[model samples]
Target: METLFDSACRYMSDSELIYEITNNKKLVTEAERQGGEYDLNGLFSSLTPGRKKVATAAIELYKRLQSRHNGQDAIRCSQDIDALIHPFLWDLPNEELWVIALNTAAKVIKKVRVSVGGISRTAVDVRLIMRILVEASATQFAVVHNHPSGSKHPSREDENVTERLKKAGTLFDICMIDHIIIAGDTYYSFADEGRL
Candidate 1:
């Protein structure tokens, strides 16, 4: 019977082994030698299980350091909006309503999934969306949902919901910036079309 170390060696390359252990593919190649082979059994046996914990701690520390200098602020235009939401909705088969709460600076504070429904439609709870905005201390928000049918045009229900949310947002001094419908790689924005 093959040992776990032997199996790992047979199944994974040096870079893959390092990535499995470190979860950092960027560290796979070094200046000295590209993906230089190491003694897998020796490496595993000599180290404590705490190596993974150490790596996790290091990653967390790095993220904290980067956040201080990161410019993860508000959207500047339709392109920014597309970049923010397309990844989440592009491949979904059913409809999902995502409400993004934004601060006074228009920076995203939180993204809440108001509802998820059938292939064509998902219910949007205005109260829940408003509650999320209030809880996040958001001054504005944008609504996004996917059309698995590959049509970017808004349905009658979509227009009605947008109107209702606009009214509710105005009442609470919160602005509804846009209603975006995404289908595959394309998107339609109500604000850009002068609907919002």
Candidate 2:
């Protein structure tokens, strides 16, 4: 049987197919940045039946990459946490809250995008954080957010959120590993400074 890609390619001019594939590749690069399960249903709905098959294949590929842990699942330090999350924060112009769920071994189970907002701030509800932790059965978690302003210092709000999460995590028997403020290539760790 012809593959989904082959079916879709039959309907597109060579140039149109090439252009669409290129754009999908760009989307794949930014998949984890979505901060949640990347939903491609809407994108597929907009295409012709044949094209939808192609989009589905692309979406499946993206999902596999987002979940692929390789041998790097265990987070060894703040730097390891930074390396895991940095790709998802790339080129993000606005603020976004990301939660990394971990097993007892410090191996990442998933990365969740809790919220996204204006350039200056993104609101995070501890309840939502709790929900994800419970769902993932995560024994430990780390929080990371970016500042487009290129300053990695934790703001008053960042400290407040860290404290709140720490208190809440304590109640759930879930340890909050660290709260990281990422700016460009640099990062500040709450745990590193004895803040968490």
Candidate 3:
């Protein structure tokens, strides 16, 4: 039976095929030496241009499929919000603020990354957030950001931002449902704690 690599080798140039075989051998050796941990980035970076394009396209396809799968459910709780936003924000080395615009039934309309900041904090523009909600015609929304430091506690800045969003949402008759802080595997929810 032909192996997957054998099948792949049929499509590669002679030089590319040799490089892949050599790289795989080196990666297997390194994995064994490192107790089964291998450099995935190294493996990806070593792929031929065509293979890299295919890999990237495959990844984007997976994300779209996963998003569509998750988007069908109405967000009923903070955990739901966490689940939706975690894949985007969690494990980031820096901070990014995102807003999830929700329809009347709490299904997601759109999720937009509003800002990217340093390791500790990110600034959010309430006007921009509102504009996105308006554009989506969302009646409810949530704010999400990650704490790279792994602190689930909301900072004073977090509190202030939440209050500002809440007030602004009121003005437009759009409800601010939750503000979530993703810290590693844990999370903080303003609505869960009666802070929203």
Candidate 4:
């Protein structure tokens, strides 16, 4: 199968420019390794401002194509959540928490980025999360956050937040499905581990 880089190159108007942009070994390796989740900054850092603009548009188009191809399928398992969410959280230098609101049948209703924080930690506001769930009319939801330090282990604070959210969801008859900690391609899912 042709790699994603090769496929992306075919869409570029100038093959030579794409070749020059992708000339760096690190860029090529990372792009090939991560598929749609590769680092945008690293990909464009060496390019001129004009080239960066072209590259940014190309990347945005690529992401749209990828998401369209993937579709918004039901979340059946932790792996499904990982595949659905990796593109959003991957390549970030800091942490971000997102909520995936699901309908009664488990199909995604919406994805909301709840918070963005420094390298190690981000605060989660339960009230804000509850408000979003209520507004979306979601019957079930999963919370996901990235670990920029590349560890999948949940901290004590992560556990506390998960417990609190689970309790809060009970009051509204909404379900807290899982808490996923993503680090690059790997992830830890509380539901999968019997922690939820």
The numbered model that scores best in TM-score is 4
Per-candidate TM-scores read 0.65, 0.66, 0.77, 0.79
Model 2 per-residue lDDT tens digits across residues 125-156: 99999999999999999999999888898888
Off by over 4 Å in 3: 1-23, 33-35, 38-61
User: What is the Å distance of residue 9 in model 1 from its true position?
Assistant: 18
For 1-196, candidate 4 gives per-residue lDDT tens digits of 9886677556654333335676566555555566546655555676778877877787677765665455477889888877777777877899999998899999988888899999999989999999999999999999999999999999999999999999999999899999999998799999989999
Candidate 2: 10-residue stretch with minimal lDDT: 62-71
| Lowest lDDT 10-residue stretch of candidate 4 | 9-18
* lDDT values for all models: 0.79, 0.80, 0.86, 0.84
C-alpha lDDT (0 to 100) for residue 147 of candidate 3: 97
* Model 4 TM: 0.79
Q: Which stretches of candidate 4 lie over 4 Å from their true place?
A: 1-17, 20-43, 68-71
lDDT of 1 at 188: 93
RMSD of each: 11.1, 9.4, 6.0, 6.0
Taking the tens digit of each residue's C-alpha lDDT, what string does model 1 give over 36-56?
855555444444468756755
TM-score of 2: 0.66
Task: Please estimate how well model 4 matches the true structure, expressed as its whole-model Cα lDDT.
Answer: 0.84
For candidate 3, give the lDDT of residue 91.
Answer: 75
